[model samples]
Target: MKRKLSILLALVMILSLALPMMAGAETVSLAYKNGSLHLRKGPGTNYGSNGYVRDGDYITVLSKGSVWSKIETSAGRIGYIKNLYISGNGANYADGTSYFGGSYTGYVVTKYSGSSVNLRAGASTSTASMGQLRNGTKIKILGENGNWYLIETASGTQGYMSKTYIKSSAGSSSSSATQYATVTGSVVNVRAGAGTQYVVKTALTRGTTVKVLEKTTSNWWKIQWGSYTGYMSANYLRMK
Candidate 1:
């Protein structure tokens, strides 16, 4: 009995020492736009897309190649993405930034700061907000007008961001682009506008999937739930 106990303790000690190393694997976040970066079975695009990671999702980098990189998603599914789409050590890469639907011209990297930067329909703050770009989000500069930079997001969201909140960066990537949000509050009230002062249009239960139309600079999401359109507090939302 004593011998058996000693052997078990030795095994436990070995496992305890090995556990940290196993969990310490290098990890990186996928910076590509929504539905664009495919986690493939092989290092190239020809391989089957076994899974996918969107902007702001973190995964483990197993190995890397010149054009492709092997990665394991947080879900433990192994795959590969174009080497350009993954960022490490909180760093951003310029070559991997993707653009869409505009005059095919040269691209420049711009940095955004603050909790969120409003992408507006025009160059002024009074213009309608098309969406909100998260902090560290990179904008591919298409053109510039005065203090505003005409930019495009990975999801093809094109708008102008103020020059005040933007800095010319070496490079950056889309961090946590809004795709969908799951309601976390138990029967949270849905406001008609982006604030509490607005009327309660309806209520959404926990686990309800909300169609994220766009985000306001105030951190409210204009969402569509069951044919009712309104804004909700972004604080109670979770992304899958």
Candidate 2:
């Protein structure tokens, strides 16, 4: 009985130390407005998407994990989102910086030939496998969840790739040449600047391809669609 009591006390101590960081009533706002951050049903991208939360929408953080946070929206909805997609209070990343979006390009790599990496339909290793990607197969990393990356293949396949076997396509994928991407959301606004307070320049429909120029300090992609050059949220653009 004494031994069990000691163990219980130790567990309580651990919880006491850890709970403050995870549970709080502090208010925060969604950060990555590339368009809107997907509100998830659970802690990771393996969970179903509840919907989307736009940038600057204030939320009450119910709990926080290293990679995900549970929040209550101003509308009183509860959902999960990546920690980097939030800011204001109690928002932080493992690297000590708040960065959202997995907009870079990546590729599958392995030590041996013929060994393919599994791309899962969700973020977990236990999730259903969509397909396998061979070594050197290029992928567009759109977002992240724990140890997996939400990726889209050239043939329009979307899935999760383990970060262990995938690496960023570093050198040849540099920003020198012209880049292009398609808008994923329905009718995303091309703004004069990065935030919602900025004037809306125009609206780009889904499947419309635009020339990517650069990302603003606030993370909006400066794009050129037709003759109009303006900024759009990074969330809505699929970096192709």
- On lDDT, the candidate that comes out on top is 2
| lDDT, candidates in the order shown | 0.63, 0.69
lDDT of 1 by residue, 1-240 (tens): 999999999999999987754663443432223334567898766789896676656666777787778777777788887655555554432123322212222223335335677777556686557668777665565444455656777777556677566544422222223346788888888898989999999999999998777655465778887789998887777643
68-129, model 2: which lDDT tens digit per residue?
A: 88988767678997665566654422121112233677778878987898877456676456
TM-score of 2: 0.38
Best by TM-score: 2
TM-score for every candidate vs. truth? 0.36, 0.38
- lDDT score, candidate 1, position 206: 93
- State model 2's lDDT: 0.69
Taking every candidate in turn, the Cα RMSD to the unseen true structure, in Å, is 13.1, 13.3
What is the Å distance of residue 166 in model 2 from its true position?
12
How does candidate 1 fare on TM-score? 0.36
